[model samples]
Target chain A: MEPPRALLFDVFGTCVDWRSSIIREGEALGRRLGLGTVDWAAVADAWRALYQPQMETVRSGARPWVTLDVLHREALDRVLADAGLQGVPESDRADFTLAWHRLDPWPDTVAGLHRLGQRFVVAPNSNGHIALMVNLSKRAGLRWDAILGAELARAYKPQPEVYLRGVEALGLVPSQVMMVAAHNVDLVAAAACGLRTAFVPRPTEHGAGQTTDLRPARPVDVVATDLGDLAGQLGA
Target chain B: MEPPRALLFDVFGTCVDWRSSIIREGEALGRRLGLGTVDWAAVADAWRALYQPQMETVRSGARPWVTLDVLHREALDRVLADAGLQGVPESDRADFTLAWHRLDPWPDTVAGLHRLGQRFVVAPNSNGHIALMVNLSKRAGLRWDAILGAELARAYKPQPEVYLRGVEALGLVPSQVMMVAAHNVDLVAAAACGLRTAFVPRPTEHGAGQTTDLRPARPVDVVATDLGDLAGQLGA
Candidate 1:
């Protein structure tokens, strides 16, 4: 098989451990708000659990497509209420909502990306809006050549359109690009569209209760321990 | 005055010394093709002289919007003929056409942008297409936050819609953006649409034959020696 000319990454749980970051940030916000002891980790897990169903609502045409920022905001409001954090001021809520933009990268992500970037065009194909992704990259030092977001497509991933649109924007054929992800579903979707796929397992992405994706579900171009290993495997 | 949250720069004369690079490259190519003792610098100047009128063709609706890549090709063809160069293969012409993608950045540009990027979002708002700009940035070490180009707007710069489209894509208000250029016309056009402006003197941009933009023609928010000075003036 021809080596991929570009690598499009799935950002959230794949590049960064969003669940733990969100829980930590939530715990701090909870303490500051005098909300008393709460299961911040559980809240983070629950909020992530809602992510798919919420997107499915839009994907299934039950609701209009909204940017991940808006989807995340809506999820935050609902989860806050469910967690019994009532009467939160709008300003405080806004702060909490932006926590997604500040998630720290996984240990191997930065150096690994820089190494891979030396060989290929590397970028995030995330549900995050362009502004959100740009800010996240700056804050986290993701070292992306460009940020490709759902906002540009007005559609979220695992949708074929997102992958196709991103490759087109890069002036690359889908076959010349690889989709790198921790999630099998995202890789599968991209593969179906003729993009090469690389899977790096992130078993704890969903936190302590995480059960699946301890390893890649299928044979992919390069399955490795982490992004650094992936970079090595790709000869980058 | 409110500080612009983003700065969009003009690329050719503003960021890179395209004329000298092209002239040097052309001279080398001329020698390889046995076209000895040719005045390649004159050819470079003649090619650059076609820039504005070529873009003007698009701006004035005499031609549909074409990327700087296409315009470069047209200009190269005209200049090659004018210089009476013989037996230039199609492949050689294609390679020559890509010279725009390989132009070297000004000495201060990379470091200056690295400094300014620590504060304000910076990007190129160029007549080049996104692919051309992206490749050029990678090749030239230009540190743009995003690549905004005429292809995205389907119009050339100095067009209000082109300026406004960049603002909207950035999720910024017009006032929150600045146009930085070596040309007074570009800054004035951007200012007319309520964006802030900065002028950087590139008196040698057109070589010793330079006759315009010795300094800013109008009151711009900041004037500086080069990008490094601009970064210093912006307190980055």
Candidate 2:
């Protein structure tokens, strides 16, 4: 088979440890806001849990087209209130919302991506909108050749349109691009769309709370330990 | 006034020295094809002359949305035949068409963009489609934060939607995004859409046949000698 000309990555849990970053930031903000004994990690998880359902609302037409940032803000507000944090200032709320913009990259992310990018057109094909992903890249030093998102397709991920739209944007057939992700479901979705797939297991993506995706979940083209390992496997 | 948070640059004349690069490439290709006495520079100029008119065809609804690469290829074919070039094989035509993908940047472009990229989000707001711009960035060493193009808006540049679409893609307000270009008319259209504007004169963009845009034709927020000067002026 022809070597992949492009590598499309799943951004959130794959390249960046969003759960830990969000929890750490949330805990710090919670303490400053005088919230005692708050389960910031749990709150972070809960906020993330809302992600799919929230996008589903838009997907199902219960909501109009809203960016991931907006969805994140709405979810944060609800989660903060439910966690019993009250009367937070609007500026603080805005700051909390902007936390998504400052996500930290996984330990091997930058170096691995840099290596891989030397050979391939590497980019993020994520549920995150282009703006959010671009800001996150700048903040976290994630070197992406381009920022692509479901927002470009007006649809969320796990949908064929997302993968197809990304390939179309790159001016390549789906087969010419490879989708690399820690999530088996994402890789499966991409494989279904006729793109090459690589699974890089992030066993601790949920930080000891992880249960699913402990191993290669399907017949993906490649299975690596991490981004660095994936880079090596790809001969980058 | 609040400083512009993002700078959107026009690519062809403003960033890459397309005229000279195309002329050089065409001349080299002409020589390789044994087309002696062929005026490649004139052919290049003639091809470029077809740019605005072709885009105008699309803009005027006489043609559909065609990428700059496709338009360039079409123009190259016409100009080659009109210039009395002979024995240009089909394979050579494909090679000549790919020349646009390998444009050389002006001397200061890489350094200027590197410096400016340190301060603000920098991207190309060009008539080139996303794939073309992205490939060009990789080929020409343009350090763009993101690639924005007319393809995303399904329209050509100087159109309000193209300018506003770029701002929206960057997740910035019109006032927070500045359109930087060598052409006064481009800035005029951008300013009319409420975007901030910067002018960097590319006096010889039209080459030895150059006759206009030796300087800013209209008032804009910032005027500079070149990208390097613009970077210094912007404190980048």
Candidate 3:
């Protein structure tokens, strides 16, 4: 197959270990607030669990377009209340919500992206807004040629427009762009929109014993153990 | 003075030498097409001279929003007719329109941007679309945190929404973002919208006889000779 001209990434899990990063940030915030023995890992998982349902509100056209930042904040409020931390101060809670923008890259993410970027135009096809993507890239040293995703399309992932709009934004046809993700469903959505697909499994994205997306559920154009392996496979 | 959190640049004359680059590309195309002794610089100047009028049609609501690519192509057709080169093939004309995406950066552009990016978010707030901005950045090795400009707002520079939307995209208040440009009018429009402004004069932007925008028309937050000087003044 001809190599893709550009690669659009599903950032949250594919490029970053959000669970560990969120938990770590939460623990630090907990220490600063002297909230002893908070279960940040559970909190992290709970917060992440709300992502799909939150975005579905927009995807389903039940609500007007709102940025991922708004969705994240709304979800944080629900997650905090569910975890019995509703007493968290407004300022601290707001600050903590930005943990999503401070996620650390997976071990091989930076180097592999740098390599892949040399051969292809790379950008995040994330649900995150431009500001969130910019901050996350700055924090993780993840360079992108552009930030093309939900915010640009004003719609969430798995929606056909999200994939198609990103392809068009790069002045490329769907087949000339590859969607790189850890989530099989995202690849399936992208493929349905006519983009090439690559799966780089992040087995522990949901922490140990994670069952979902540990492997590609269906055949994709490329699949590898991680970003570095994927980069090598693509001759980057 | 408080430093700005992000810098939004006007790409055409501020960061890249569009005149010489377009001329060079035109001459090379002329050579390949066996069109000898063509005054490429005149053609380049004529093409650029049409930019504002073309965009004005959109800004005045006389036309619906379209990318700079469309405007450039439309202007290129007029320019070729005016220059007596209307016989150029459609394929060649389409390829030639992308010359905007391959402009060479000013001597200090890449290094200055590298240094400035270390301290503040750097992005293009030009009228160019994301694909144009991305291709230009990649070709010039001019890195950007995001591509925020005309296409994002569906409006061209000097339009209030263009500056406002770029500031919003970076999650920055207008005062916290600096609009850097070689054109006095661009900075004036940005300043009118409450953004900080910087002037870096490109004295030869229109070639040796260029008389406009050789200096800032009014007081701005900072005035520098070029990108390197601007970087140093901004403490980047």
Candidate 4:
């Protein structure tokens, strides 16, 4: 089959190396605070653990719509308190939460994106709001044909509206747009919405002992080792 | 005062020389149809003139929300019929309506956006939906830091929600983002929503004999000859 006209990415670990980057930034903040011996990676993992539940409130209509930045900030505060890493100033916490906006892409992301951009429109179908996506794109030099996804739907990923509206925004039917992610769940959701799907496993997204999504847990149209391999497979 | 961190543009006439671009494309289509001696320029103006009233129907709840593409398509059919350019093929008519997507940016647009990209986050806060804006950006090389506007707000410009939500998506207060446009009406509405405004006149946007918005009709934070001047004045 021919390739889709646009590729929408589930960005956190699919495009950007969120785990290591967040840990590195968290550790630096811990060092500056003299909060010795903090498990920065663990903090990063724990903080991400809160992502789904926090978004659930909004999805369930228990809360007004809030962007991922707000979700991340609130999650960080609670995670820090629970981990007994309190006393980090609100200003520092705010800055630390912004680490999501400064993630480093996998070494292959930039070059692969450049190649793929020649063929298809590339954008982050991220839960990250437009601002976070903008900052991340600017910092990482990931040239997107457009910025799109969740904020436009006023909902989080896996919501039908998010994937539906994502394809709609591209002025294409879902079948003409592919949702590429490192996670099977995201692919599952997108496929259910009638979009094409690709899974590029980020085995170490949660570090060396990562259990989930070590491989494509379910069927997808394309499965590659990394974005570079994906680009090659897609003929970009 | 410090320049805003983000600049949201009005796309139709501000960044793109839509009149010339549309006229050129329309005349080509006209010739293809063997409809000799058609005044394509007037058709372009008449089509654009329908933009406000079309959007106003949605604004006033006279119709359900329809995207700019749909609105343009509807308006194009009416404009063609009125001009006696009837019975155009469905596919050809659809492609013609997308002339907005193929608009040529003003000569200064690419260079000025590049300059401004060094400092402020640049985006098109246009009534144009994400796809049209995305196509325009790729075709014209207008680098946008983000895309936010009518589609997200479910309304067209001049609606306070458009400006308010546009700013909110950037995670900034309205005052921290400038709305740059060639139309005084746009700046007036943006200002009413607390956004900083810049007026850059495109006196020839409606073709020769156009008289409105020859100068700033309302006080704007900056008035520049074009985007390049705006970039220079804003120190980007």
Q: Model 2 Cα displacement at A28 (Å)?
A: 2.4
Candidate order by lDDT, highest to lowest? Answer: 3, 4, 2, 1
lDDT of 3 by residue, A1-236 (tens): 89999999999999999999999999998889888888999999888888899889888889988887788789889988988888889998889889899999999999999999998999999999999999999978999999999888999999999999999888999999999999999999999999999999998999889899988888899998888888899999
CA error at residue A35 for candidate 3, angstroms: 1.4
Candidate 2 local lDDT, B39-115, one digit each (tens): 76788789889989999999998989988768987887888788876468888887787777778888889989989
DockQ of each: 0.45, 0.65, 0.83, 0.70
Model 4 misses residue A145 by how many Å? 2.2
Which residue pairs overlap in candidate 1's backbone? none
Global lDDT scores for all candidate models:
0.84, 0.86, 0.92, 0.90
Which runs of model 2 end up more than 4 angstroms from their true locations? none
lDDT of 4 by residue, B173-235 (tens): 988999999999999999999999999999888878888889998789999999889989999
**Position B8, candidate 4: lDDT:** 92
DockQ for model 4?
Answer: 0.70
- Number of the candidate with higher DockQ, 3 or 4: 3
C-alpha lDDT of candidate 3 relative to the true structure: 0.92
Q: TM-score for model 4?
A: 0.96
How many residue pairs in model 4 have overlapping backbones? 0
Q: lDDT (0-100) at residue B13 of candidate 2?
A: 89
Residues A60-168, candidate 4: write the lDDT tens digits.
Answer: 9999888888899999999999899788998999999999999999998999888888778888899998889998988898988887888888888888999998888
